[model samples]
Target: MLDRSRTREGHSPAEALRDTVEFARRAEALGYHRFWVSEHHGVPGVAGSAPTVLAAAVAAATSRIRVGTGGVMLPNHRPLVVAEQFGVLESLFPGRIDMGLGRSVGFTGPVRRALGHDKDDADRFEGQLAELLGYFTGANEVPGLPAEGLRVPAFVLATGAGAGIAARHGLPLVIGAVRGEEPMLRAVRDYRAEFRPSPLAAEPYVVVSLSVAVAATAEEAWRLLVPEAWAMAHSRTRGVFPPLRPAAEVLALPMTARERSLFEQSLRGHLFGTPAEIAESLDALVARTGADEVLVTTSTHDRAALLDSYRLLADAAGGR
Candidate 1:
């Protein structure tokens, strides 16, 4: 489960964060293997700004569930700093920490400038990743705190050109299952074919991520996606990403042709429906891509319903 700790229309950022911790507990009890939080900066709809800090909170709050970032953007910070943070986390949490890293800097120009990185900084992700791994393996001369001999499982998020990078580093690849299946499948195929064994991993591994909402009926599940879809459309068109609103409220608002088009576009490529429907979809997805794991990232305005969706999904997937 990769939660962004989205703030709803009526909730405060603090409340949203607390909700994430509580949700983590629910997810653990429901048999989830890991609970991951995401990183987002200067986004009105998201409250998960500092992923490592939030991860510490989650780790301290839960005992059995694995905790980590869905990821921390490497281009935005020095690799040594990230290595130190994760080292501390691993020291405290031991085996339950994961280091999911990404190359994204910021969404807009101002945000990028604020982060002290330009767009091209993302091009250095491969080097940054290598350096981060070097710190863990003691390949670097700099003697450090716990960063030098700690092994926190690291996974590379497949953002542009990321599939190749993961393969070259012999790390686990985390790719989205959306934006159509053909391209995603091709990337995974290429990753496996081009993979090189390293100290981190001996074989290619893929974790496919996508938003999923399971309900008693198809319509109910579909409605659960409306909040996120609307928010995405508004962000793309207006440049202002607001909090999630109720589906009924969003449905009643009038949208321009472009907004309507973007709204529908955002709603595509998701897994939603009853348990039987989702079970079939999961089986086909695994058979098609041979994904090692499915990382579910679903968001909605209805908190109780959101929890229900995961519960149903756990029952449907049966600990997979």
Candidate 2:
């Protein structure tokens, strides 16, 4: 399960962080394989700006569930700093820590500047990734900082050119399922075809991340997804990603025709339905994409509904 620590309507960012930790504990108890947090800089709706720090908190809170970044945007920080941070995490949690890296710069130009990342830094992802791996494997060394000699499992947050990067580095690819099926499957195929056996990963492994919402009825599940879909639409149209609002309020808001179109389109990629329905859809997705693992990432306005979605999803995935 992945949590961006979304600050929904009627909730503070602090509350979102606390809720995320609580959610992680519950997910662990419910038998989730891993619980991941995301990194979002200068996004008011998201409170997970420092995934490594938050991961430490999560690791301390839960015993069984593997804790890691959904990913840390590698372009935002120095490769040495990232390695050290994850090295510390791996030392503390031992075999339970993960380091999923991404090439994305901040969402906006100002945010990018604030993070001291240029547009060109994104292009340096492959190099950054190599440097990160070198720290753990003792292949490449920094003069001042010694290699940690810790082997932290690494995953690339795959998208566009990222699949090729992951394949080249021999790291597992983690792609979002929000992209349509054909494109996603094609990306997976390309990743596997191009994969090289490095010291980190000897074979290709793909993890598909799906935005999920399960309920007693499909209608209720769709309701739970509305807040996130609408927020995504608003971000596209207004250039500002605001905190998620109540679904009823979102429905009542007067939106431009284009915004309404975008809202509906955004809803298309999600897997929302009753447990049986979601399970069937997810199974088909896994079969089609040949995903080695499935990761669920969901955010909603209502805290109770959000937790319930995880419960239903866990039940649905148990048989898999």
lDDT of 2: 0.90
Residue 81, candidate 1: alpha-carbon lDDT: 90
Model 2, range 218-244, lDDT digits (tens) per residue?
999999989999989989999989899
Candidate 2 ranges beyond 4 A from true positions? 143-147
Report the C-alpha lDDT of model 1 over 1-320, residue by residue, as the tens digit. Answer: 99999999989999999999999999999999999999999999999999999999999999999999999999999888999999999999999999999999898899999988899999999999998898898887775458788878999999669999999999999999555788899999999999999877899999999999999999999999999999999999889889999999999989999999999999999999999999999999899999999999999999999999999999999955
Worst 10 residues of 1 by lDDT: 138-147
TM-score of each: 0.98, 0.97
Model 1 reaches what TM-score against the true structure? 0.98
Q: Please report how far candidate 2 places residue 293 from its true position, in Å.
A: 0.6
Candidate 1: stretches off by over 4 Å:
none
